[model samples]
Target chain A: MELLLTYDVSTTTPAGRNRLRRVAKLCEGYGMRVQKSVFEIVCTEPELLTLIDKVQRIIDHDEDSIRIYRVPKGSFRTVRMFGTAKPLPHDDALIL
Target chain B: MELLLTYDVSTTTPAGRNRLRRVAKLCEGYGMRVQKSVFEIVCTEPELLTLIDKVQRIIDHDEDSIRIYRVPKGSFRTVRMFGTAKPLPHDDALIL
Candidate 1:
């Protein structure tokens, strides 16, 4: 499945900054960064569960928001991108 | 239907800034702003189509990306929000 992951992490304190970095790193491991705080992840069911679990653990439930949108494979056809950023290369094979 | 709208508008030029403002204004009409560039919208099928059409016209298709995710009504139960932002109030009666 293809997933669009977007998050907002509070950065009012040093701990919050750390959590932000932690969340970004965890997301990077599972997918490619599409923007500062957005990622496009292509993963299987198990991988998706693991990624969500790891992110949930790192973020403070009271101060952060992480939204995962499950998109059907090949649905990028409807995704429109203009300017410098290109759409996620959906044609690439998933190693998993 | 409920929609999650997210967009990234290029601001490298004066015209781009204008586009950003226009896009923001268009979105504000159809939903509540969740963040700088995110919104939670509650609308009917026709409203959704109208919103998308207006947005697509205001944006520079080559320089902006707008994504709309459709979520079933009452599905917000899975939405998790931490920190200062609260989840979109799902119980409010839709005047439409």
Candidate 2:
């Protein structure tokens, strides 16, 4: 039900933003926004497939790329525990 | 020192695979291969910037998308504990 879609767009041009907008729109129907350019799409299997199809159609530019990583239903939440900016502690002692 | 580069290519064509090959080649200069299409690139900050530059040059197809996630240096190792297919346990008791 949760997916991590990480993508890159050619920030050098307007076309890139347009492509990203399409991706955002596609995600709107499925899940909540997580981080910048990362969406937490919550949906059933069939709906998620439809969302993927819609996303593929909207992303027509070769300069832009998106990867939809399906984390075994619950991994996404754990990854979020650390947030995005804080790097993990090098000492093994820091892990909970 | 570890980064997760998750990419999607149009498996429908050879161009997508070629783009991925470029990505793999780019990663070779810095780290070890972990899983299929995933690498554990180890390098200093400057080296990583250079690798990203090379990756951009080799990948020219819009049909394929790649996302390079820089883990907080330690998170990748924990994720590995779960492997790729097992879903996280719903009960917090399973977490180490």
- Using all chains and alpha carbons, the TM-scores for the candidates as numbered come to 0.64, 0.44
Per-residue lDDT tens digits for candidate 2, residues A1-96, read 555565555444677678767777667656644433555556677876677667767664444455555554544434422112222231222111
Any residue pairs clashing in model 2, and if so which? A62-B62
Model 1 misplacement above 4 A: A10-18, A82-85, A91-96, B9-25, B43-65, B70-77, B80-86, B90-96
- Per-residue CA lDDT of model 1 for B1-96, tens digit only, reads 666677766565888779877877777666666665666777887887787778878887776777766654554555544444466654553423
- Highest lDDT: give the candidate number: 1
Clash pairs of candidate 1? Answer: A62-B83, A63-B83, A82-B62, A83-B62, A83-B63
Off by over 4 Å in 2: A80-96, B1-96
